[model samples]
Target: MREVSSDCRVAWFLGLAGLIPFVAGGVIAWWGSSAWQVTAVYGFSYYSAVILSFLGGVHWGSALQVPRPDNRRRLFIAMVPSLIAWPALLFNVVTGLWVLLAGFILIGGYDLSRDGREGFPAWYFKLRGLLTGVVVAFHLIVLLRLGG
Candidate 1:
């Protein structure tokens, strides 16, 4: 495999750091007292939604790199994450988390489909895949903790 560049390595570091809250939230929900658990779950879900929208913004950055930007396609895709995330905030925790998980998975699928081969760097895509898997797993654990 090709070595990741310095910039990409930094991004990978920060991206993994971002997962702290996601994992912490799930752990908190699983282990905390009732009151603390509620706070952690809400905060986790909220933050997850925020990050979802940020992923959409990454696509915007990608779109900017295009010579003759396809504003319709690129911009439309960029808006999708925020749209999916907003409603997740309104529902109950278990349901909201399910929505967030779906959004993450959908966005991950879009990223891989759109640029996995030619557009995005191999290292970047691999990092994204790794992050997405962990995020989804945390959400699932959170959901099961809440529901079961």
Candidate 2:
């Protein structure tokens, strides 16, 4: 493997750091006190929505990186995640979780399918894959905890 630059090292650190809440929320849902379970789920759901929205913004940023009249499609795609997230928040706890889960899968799948061809660095797609996997896993854990 090639030596990763300091920038990559920092990105890796911060990206992994972002997973802390997901891990905590899932663990707490599965094993924390009963009193904390509800709170854990809510926190996890909210955080997931935020992350989903953030993913959309990343696309927006990328689209702006090379602005053009034809980039409107990309910009429209960018808004889809936030649209999904908002409705997910409106649904019941279980349904909302499902919506957010779908949102992650949708966006993550779309990103991965591009295989860094969308102008992002290869390392970014790799990091996104790892982070998305962890995020989805925690979503499953929380859902199962809720008996969904």
Candidate 3:
């Protein structure tokens, strides 16, 4: 078997992390009849945080492509939004989603700005932007439905 690329591995992990909330939320919303406070507080919140944090790790891992220590440091600094947003999301989905949106904005901006540059692959940035857009849309739909 071929060894998996680190980036691919990271992406897969992040994707799996994201799916946890989607699945848990769907299950709770479907089967659990009585509002399911425990599911919301424990399951949803915890899964959201884990997903956000893993997504941040994906960004941090990708930043390794920037060779210079200073550049990598700057990229890491840019990743801080992911770190902050995850835990906040655990408390409040609206606020957390907003924070994540901000992080996605910053990351997307960085990706767009760096496109065609020597260090980063253009497709990777494009893919990230697309994934972020999808996540943002999903979050919006969820919020609207939940009235959050």
Candidate 4:
């Protein structure tokens, strides 16, 4: 395992805090007034899409470490998440949020795959999984509560 630095731990903490909006948004969407629900749902959906695309950029940075042919492939793969995310925002509330949920799960799994084959740190994958799981759960809460 690679030695995790203070900066990495800080990033993880910040990432964990990042989940608050999702959970809060979901809760507000589920229980708040009509206006607030609309705001929460749309806000959550937009942020989720943005964060999903951001994660793809993170992978793009990682791809630069890889050599030649493999790096080319990795770079291509890195762009896929952003592409998926951007179009999701064009979709309706439920469909778009579902897409975001899937993106997080899919990318978390991709990160785990990188851990196995591309030397992504195991600790990092674990962190990714935890964050992704929370995000998915919160998304599910909003989805189910809204009957979507």
The best candidate by lDDT is 2
lDDT of 2 by residue, 1-148 (tens): 8989999899999999999999999999988898898888999999999999999999888888966665688788889999999889888889999899999999988787652247688899889989999999999888898888
Error of 2 at 104 (Å): 0.7
Evaluated against the true structure, the overall lDDT of model 3 is 0.57
lDDT of 4 by residue, 88-133 (tens): 9999888988888888888877777744247465567667788888
Q: Sort by lDDT, best first: what order? A: 2, 1, 4, 3
User: In TM-score terms, which candidate is top?
Assistant: 2
Candidate 1: TM-score? 0.91
Q: Could you tell me how far off, in angstroms, the CA of residue 91 lies in candidate 1 after the best superposition?
A: 1.4
Q: In model 1, which range of ten residues has the least summed lDDT? A: 113-122
* Residue 99 miss distance in model 4 (angstroms): 1.5
Candidate models: Cα lDDT each: 0.86, 0.88, 0.57, 0.82
What would the TM-scores of all predictions be?
0.91, 0.93, 0.59, 0.89
Clashes of each: 0, 0, 0, 0
| Model 1, CA-based lDDT | 0.86
User: Stretches of candidate 2 above 4 Å error?
Assistant: 68-70
Candidate 2 structure lDDT: 0.88
